[model samples]
Target: MSHHSIEARDLAFSYPDGTVALDGVSFEITHGESVAIVGANGAGKSTLLMHLNGFLTPLRGSVRVGDVPVIKSTLSDIRKAIGTVFQDPDDQLFMPSVYEDVAFGPMNLGLPLEEVDARVIEALTQVDALRLKDRPPYRLSGGEKRAVAIATVLAMRPNALILDEPSSNLDPRARRRLIGLLGTFTHTKIIATHDLDLAMDLCERTIVMSGGTISADGRTGDIFTDDALLDSCGLERPLSMQNCPKCGRSD
Candidate 1:
């Protein structure tokens, strides 16, 4: 088995309108590592996550999850290994009931019915949404809906968890809960978000994206301390008053 969980080599993509999203981006995420991709709006963060799961094919180069390449012939297999959660919960959760939404991926994978049921229950429990399993997805609060969306992907037990703006639109309490839940998972985690506070708390490493390419990749503490670099990327330095649990050091 390969040591790297995800590898992108000289990847590039352009939209139908000739707008470039990713420009020869290359990086590798190691197994069991927690990484945050930080960038301003339209920095190609979401575009990169799409390539990780084969949702968007690169106009050039390639993306690989473990030993499997994210090509058309292997897209399904690659998706099974990497569960991607979009920034908006509504984009991911469309089923009527929470249970059904969480069960969708497992069912699509053709797991046995009983196994799927068990996975659904486990996933809901993971996100502390077991009590809302039968509730209508539309009725849940923003935080609740986001939890369900995460549960939907977790039910498949993907090898790597790729979350885009996982803490977006969440209240402080909800954000704390989400972070706690993420801390329990041991899989390789890649999160793309502008929430530098959350990234400092959760990720050991941070990759800075700008103009469709990675501008910096290093320890989270090192990246956050550089004011000039943060300014260049249109990101503010993480507040000096905040405490980061992962580093066991507070500013």
Candidate 2:
């Protein structure tokens, strides 16, 4: 069987007030690939990520998830196949309890009660949030809420995971723990983040966006090493690169 993954071609979008968010952006991620979308604020990274799951329709192009175009007919299935975790945990953790929040996706998919229960348990266990399953989402720490938000999507067993600014507002320990958890997922991952360290730790490929356009796309190592390109995109070299013995560069 031929397995196609996420593909976007000539995508363009604009805000209600005529602010262009994405312009002629195109990229393809193979199945199981981990890619990072890096850009400064208002660089259109979030808008592009939204396209992957059909949350926002493109004004002048197309997007496909596993050969299914992101149209109204395929929106539900597409969303199921490509799960998204918002930058803010509160945006996704709306259900009263962690268990309910985690179960929401599978339940909405019309799975049987037993299957939903199993999925809830499995997802929570994967994120190490099983102990907090009964607790209200608001009561948990920021990291805990982030984990539970991820669990909500995992319960659906999506083929691809999309996360926006996932490392924002996390302490060092919590951030490291999240990196470890995300490392274990075999599914394709597309993380849009300003956290270059997280990008270096997780993604093999890096895509750089600027002014609603793709300015660079290549191996993570090369992209991070190109100081001029990073500078152009309002990014800096990954700390690991800067502190490398071989590169011999410092602040």
Candidate 3:
């Protein structure tokens, strides 16, 4: 892969139970772009993210990260370029301590101990979780775990970051902090979420999916403002775009 740009071309997938997850979904995300995929439950947002990182392969189409295609033989290379942070922090953090969890990726790659230690410290510092290094991940609060989970991915030094429902189960302050943390990164980010407000805050481009296909792809502001489009796909205007109930003002 090169520059970490992502591309999905005419992709299609079906679950083992014969439920269709994606059908003819296609989009190209350029390097360093922040893109959001938003839709209702069962709209296939998570499935698509999984395909990008090779966690699930498309039955019919293909995905490319930069120039590298996501195939079984290149799975390692693909994963190395694309770091995925799943919807649940618990699914990610399992090591005894935050430091060990963050160091796991680099260690698995057989890097020198010095390199692994440096990477662990760097990743933790980036997520503002260095102070939590020696603590057990299971003992952390929701926000701390979220930060540490992100630190785990950052340690891999992936070119593009894929996150699913990253703001779920967080308090307002924690959500705000997550947003600020994500904004500081220069790498490409593709976020799948129900949180339109977070999408508006982080993504410049938004893709709307419905029935396992892309219904719309455009500017985040344009997509959020289109009430009919959102309604058709079971979405609502972001809170920032909606008029306030108290004073009838829109952000």
Candidate 4:
């Protein structure tokens, strides 16, 4: 599915105040690939993702979702192919009930009521959240909100998923649940997160960004094992890869 692949060419962007967020960054993510974008707080991980679905336009360079350019004229169609789940579930879930929130996207697409209903059921079922369909978003536990937020995106049936900090703010069980949920998606996934363990679990490939540019891009294991490299990027080995307190640090 070449049409589902994403590519960025020489991407460069600067904020209004003249802060360079990305500088000549470029990469390609093939269809069905789950890729992790990792970096420090201001490393430009978020900025790079914003350009994928036309949430932000590049000052110089181009991004293409398959054959479609991520430009103003193609935004509507592009959005239909890419569903983004923001870091905060509250940002995506605003309807009174879980059902409405899941149905919102397909409904906006002018789908028939029957089709929308089918989609909501399928999405909620996928997340194993059918039981919470009637609950208010605000009333949900952090994990519940995360599941529903993802369901809202799944309901749209996009070929790719863009998640910004999908594991953020969740308790251990909630985070593990989120990881399991995401592991089941066949769609192309581009996740921006500080959750190195999640990256290790879900992605085969990883891109490390620094100062608005990529410092490393390779298999997740190779990238994560390089202590000096990760340390330079303001990160450390994931807990799973670390030595135990009595074992001392592993090489």
Candidate 5:
């Protein structure tokens, strides 16, 4: 399989009420790279991710997954290529049982029963949620539901993974488990989050957003160390970086 890349060119969007969400945003994510989109609330991070998967059409400019533009004609293919996991597992885990939820995408792809079953099992195992296959989604704990939500997308075998606020509302153990799980995926990953520590751990590059524009984009360490930029973006250095005097971390 060829590597997957995403490109946005001069993207602009605004709400019907005339609130601009993105302003001439442009960037390219190389194949197999994990990048972080970080900003305070209302920085346009979620709006940009929605555009990537064709959930919302840009008012101007365009988004392309590989060579396919994210227009109506190519939306089906774009959705298949980009699997997005939203912050709330409840948004994705609608199927009754874990097994059914994980199987939904593969089943829709029209794979044979045997193939769909195999994909379901494999995806569930990847997230260490195989045992939850027989359980009801509503009965699961927050972390378990998150893992299953990821499995639902993984069974589709997408070329890229886009996550929003992935580590939100997790306990310490659950957070660490998620970090480990995300690390195992080889797909091109673009995570939009306010969790700086999670971004530092999972992504080599960080793109800082402010007021619907990309204010800074560079190595995670460099971006975090730019006190002026951080302040301008309404962010501070992560506690991990602050605690470690010699962190000198760069991706």
Candidate 6:
């Protein structure tokens, strides 16, 4: 079997208005690895995440999940293997109730009703949102909504998870909870975010995108330590913090 869980080769994308979003970007993520895609706004982080699950077909080159090429004919398979959480939970969690939103994926996957129910419960529990199952998604706090969105995708049991700004708009406590929750999942993960600290804490590797192309890819520590490259890509170095008795040091 191939070692790569997801692979992109010379990928390129353009908007309808003719703005290029990705240009010849390529990389491979192994199974169960956690990777962060970091860049400034409009650097194509969201566009790259969309390509992983076949939401957006490439204008040139290719993307593969497992060994399956992400094309029109294989879109369904690719999507089933990769779960995506958008930057805004409002965009992802549209069902009236939290339970319904979490159950949506499994239900669409054609699982038995009982199995779907079980999956939803398990997913919500994993994200610590089971208590909100009966609540309307619109009523949840920002962090709760984010957790619910993640639970919705988790219910489908995808092999890989693609998250856009997973910790955006969250308070410190909520952000820590989210980081801990994500750390428990074993699937391959590709996180697109501007939060350098979150990336440093959660990902082993980092890929820097600028002008729609991957300019740097390396160990998280190495990438974060390169001040010059980070500046060139319009990224800031992760904040240095003193060790705390409770949490060691800030990530």
Considering lDDT, which of the candidate structures 2 and 4 is the better prediction for this target?
4
Give the winner by lDDT.
4
Stretches of candidate 3 exceeding 4 Å from the true structure: none
Report, for all candidates in order, the number of backbone clashes. Answer: 0, 0, 0, 0, 0, 0
Worst 10 residues of 6 by lDDT: 238-247
Error of 6 at 57 (Å): 1.3
Q: Which ten residues in a row have the lowest lDDT in candidate 5?
A: 242-251
Which regions of candidate 1 fall more than 4 Å away from where they truly are? 1-4, 240-251
Tens digits of lDDT, candidate 6, 1-251? 24547889999999999999999999988899999999999999999988887889899999877778898899887787788999889999999999999988898899999999999999999999999999999999999999999999999988889899999899999999999999989889999988889888889999999999998999999988888999899987776522465777665
Model 3, residue 162: what's the lDDT?
Answer: 92
Q: For model 3, how does the per-residue alpha-carbon lDDT over 1-251 read when each residue is reduced to its tens digit?
A: 45677999999999999999999999999999999999999999989998998889899999988888899999998888889998889999999999999999999889999999999999999999899999999999999999999999999999989999999999999999999999999989999999999999999999999999999999999999899999999999988889998999775
Cα TM-score of candidate 3: 0.98
In candidate 6, which residue pairs get closer than 3 Å at backbone N, Cα or C atoms, i.e. clash? none
TM-score of each: 0.93, 0.96, 0.98, 0.97, 0.96, 0.94
| lDDT ranking from best candidate downward | 4, 3, 2, 5, 6, 1
**Candidate 3 C-alpha error for residue 41, in Å:** 0.4
- Tens digits of lDDT, candidate 2, 176-195: 99999999999899999999
Q: How does model 5 score by TM-score?
A: 0.96
Q: Please give the lDDT score for candidate 4.
A: 0.94
> What pairs collide in candidate 3?
none
Residue 26 shift from truth in candidate 1, angstroms: 0.7
- Candidate 3 global CA lDDT score: 0.93
Writing each residue's lDDT as its tens digit, candidate 5 over 1-251 gives: 25578999999999999999999999999999999999989999999999999998999999888877889988778888899998999999999899999999998889999999999999999999999999999999999999999999999999999999999999989999999999999999999988899999999999999988999989998998888899988998987777555765542
Off by over 4 Å in 4: 249-251
